[model samples]
Target: MKSLQKLATIALAIILMGSCTAQEEATTLKDALKDYFYIGTALNVPQVAGQDPQAIEIVKTHFNSVVAENCMKMMYLQPEEGVFFWDEADAFIEFAEANDMQVIGHTLVWHSQAPRWMFVDENGDQVSRERLIERMKTHVQTVVERYKGRVHGWDVVNETILDDGSWRQSPWVRIIGPEFVQMAFEFAHEIDPDVELYYNDYSVSRPEKRDGIYNMVKDLIDNGVKIDAVGLQGHLSMDFPTVEMKEEALQKLASLGVKVMVTEMDITVLPWPSRRHSAEVSLNYEISDEYNPYPNGLSEESYTALMDKYVDFFEMFMRNKDIISRVTVWGVDDNQSWRNNWPIRGRTDYPLLFDRDYQPKSAVTRIIELANAKKQ
Candidate 1:
């Protein structure tokens, strides 16, 4: 009887050891793909300050890189002309340094979230090209110079091109003409030559926008601009941006001889407000059941579909990993995702790898498995 009890205890210990080994092997996204490329998510004020314990742990465990979701933007950093707010931005850098994680400054120039003071005079008239250029230099240099060697990269200019293969006609374009993009890149490089400068935009998988980005980057390089990378905001939606389209787009972006990064990626499993798949914040639709079909939660079938979509996208990222330097999800999980009220308000959308409960969904394991399988 004593010998039988000992055998049972030893068998139970062996099973426990096997489970521990498996858990250790594939615990987090950062660990799973540490050898491939950097994986990251955007960090908000709460997460940066350790106000949200769950989010802090999630970020520490699953990601090796982070981008400021909003605090580093022009509006947040410098609400006034010369008054730069460094509290939140400084805290972000401190947190990143403490954790040994890389940080990416969201943007130095963008049409959206740009302070109106920089574009207009006290009399409410638009600033001249020279005036606007000076302002741009001041903002870009102050921000970039402050964080020199601390950040991995900066999205120098964002969303300069439109979906129709034309310029977006932003104030920068109206005031400084098309040269603002190059100027932003140059100003950043002037401050920190070692930092990577990226021109980030969304809807890159659409043929028109993709071609526009390609043409623009090609022009910049031809003109001897110091641009380093192209960041495609991978705000993917279900049934849009087919894998074939992404492959072609990735190859085209890489052909420019600049590294490619899938920045701000998130897969929206919800139905679109319109047929248009865009990240434009101005676009909004009235709330309706048709648009918010999954208010309760995602169906089993839909969840599986979402998982499959994630696997497909990760496979593509891995396929182009040589040219791809980093792949960052836009948010940590469903609850924190901006998709909650984007385009259509008051909707529950399960678009990320983790659910609302902070439990990683099926795609986490599947993605890690896919990466390991490729290695094997």
Candidate 2:
């Protein structure tokens, strides 16, 4: 009986020590990058509602900022004129406050996900410019006022510029002119002057689009519009937008005296489609096995390639830390990444720091080491 008791005591001690080591090894990304910039992730409905235990744990353990992936968009927030839904957005903000995380209102104006009623009347004809502008003001003011001080930042306008440096023919522009962008910014500022306002978009690293964004921001500042930051949606891949391209764009945007944020950062490991520049959110491809190459799982070589790509981007981010204010991963883990269903549906893509099991990937350790080294 004495020998048995001794063995049990030793086993318990070993288990405790192993647990401690694992916890220690799980260095939180937020802490690692605390000196540099905010580490953030987008929260899907499951995460925002506290339904996914594993994802919520990862968010609390690793991130300091959060954005709603869809809940705060115009369609969901204001499905009809003068009818605003606050259940999901309210819960999201509450969750952020409870966790002591910074919250970003994803967008006030975008071509997609906005209700068609705003652009058309009961007769299905385009609303007059005066009517459209008034509706825009009301929507922006109401949304921004509701979360004035609670939300730290707002993407007032999203994906407004095209690859050719021209304004995308969004309904807002079609009816109210490009000044709609400026109006949205002004309204947001009027409600919450302290909150940061950002112009968010993808494909910002392309030279033409980058130039367009720079000019637009410069114009806004020149006209006394309060634009605080530029959010470059970092939905990148392993190959395109080389480090030099990204750095050049960052430097140029920073030169305008506005902070830059790498929002929605993720790397799709799957093969690119032919129409890569199409900014259509609803675009999809027919299911094909060729596109889903790693259906079984990523091989050692593929995984290494993904890690290397992330490290390269992190190194670039560290080098440009002065201008970058925040680096937000698109989702908490690979299982929740939008890439799995984008361009091609039903394809498995690993594009984030955490794996499907909620374990930190090797890149997480490498990034922590990089951050720590920078601090030293």
Candidate 3:
């Protein structure tokens, strides 16, 4: 009887040891880049609400930081004047906090997606410049104060500078002039001095746009404003903005003595609407078969090309890890990526590290291998 008991104990011990080994073998993206910088992903409404178990699991396993894909946007957060919706945004913050992930508040101010009421009056005319400035002040202070110390960083301003090294004629720019960008940053700092402030924009690798952004940030710093970082929205493609261009942009931004972050990164494996390099391109076209190239699924050739592009970009990022603070993929998976519906609607695009089935692509493995090599 004593011998039987001893054998059972031995079997239990072996099983426990095997379980421990399996757990340790679960190397994640966050773990791979732990010593270098944060690996992050943007979470949509469904994932933040716990409706998408597979996406949530992927985020938990691979990422150490979280940004809301839409919940925290000004339009969604404040649909009407003087009325702010906090349900989804609150849940998003809670989810990130529960997961022990750093939270990034995406876009306190942007030209697009903002409510029309903000720029127009009851008679459908643009509000007075004074009125607009006050409204912006209230909006920035209210949102930043609500989250206070919970959010570690904020994309305080977004896409204000055009690609031609001039300010975009956005409503904010038109009403409050170029100083609106400065005002937004100042308000955020006044509300929470600890929160890191960032100016985020797409197509930042283009020379003209890079110069414009650098000058804007440099001017703000010269004026005694606290600009912590510049977020280069890495909505890249397979062909444009070569590695050298991206490196030059990063080097210039870092030279200004401000931290850099690769925010909203995704490599689109699809055709472009036009020759423009901007990801904000939103040309609408009637549904057609030609536009949907990968209707069935991505061929092995296309898959390999996509993986190569991702690995190449990751290599560049690792090379400049000193200036780049965090690297965030725009969505959790290809199925949820904004590329599927933007510029051309209903077109399937594989632009993230995970497939629609929640499986990590070949690029994820290659990226992990690259990061591990650096450690060694």
How does model 1 fare in lDDT? 0.88
By the lDDT metric, which is better: model 1 or model 3?
3
| Cα lDDT over the full model 3 | 0.90
299: Cα error in model 1, Å: 0.6
TM-score of 1: 0.93
Clashing pairs in 1: none
**Cα RMSDs, all models:** 4.8, 7.0, 5.7
- Candidate of highest lDDT: 3
**For each predicted model, how many residue pairs clash, with residues at least 3 apart or on different chains?**
0, 0, 0
lDDT of each: 0.88, 0.90, 0.90
Compare candidates 1 and 2 on lDDT and give the better one: 2
Query: Once superposed on the true structure, which residue ranges of model 1 sit more than 4 Å away at CA?
Result: 1-24
Cα lDDT tens digits, model 1, 1-376, are 9999999999999999978866667557887787778998998998888878888888888899999999999999999999999999999999888899989999889989988798998899988888899999999999999999899899999999999989999999998999888888888899899998899999999999999989989989998988888988889888888878887888899988989888898888888867678899788889888888888988899988889988998898898888888999999889989999898888888888877888898899989887766765
Candidate 3 local lDDT, 309-341, one digit each (tens): 888988999989889899999999999898888
Tens-digit per-residue lDDT, 1-376, candidate 2 = 9999999999999999978865664367898888788999999887777689999999999999999999999999999888999999999999999999999999898989998799998799999999888888899999999998899999999998998899988898998999999999998898888999999998889999999999999999999999989999888887877888888999999999999999999888888776565435777888688889998779899899989889889889988899999999999988888889998889999989999899998999999988877765
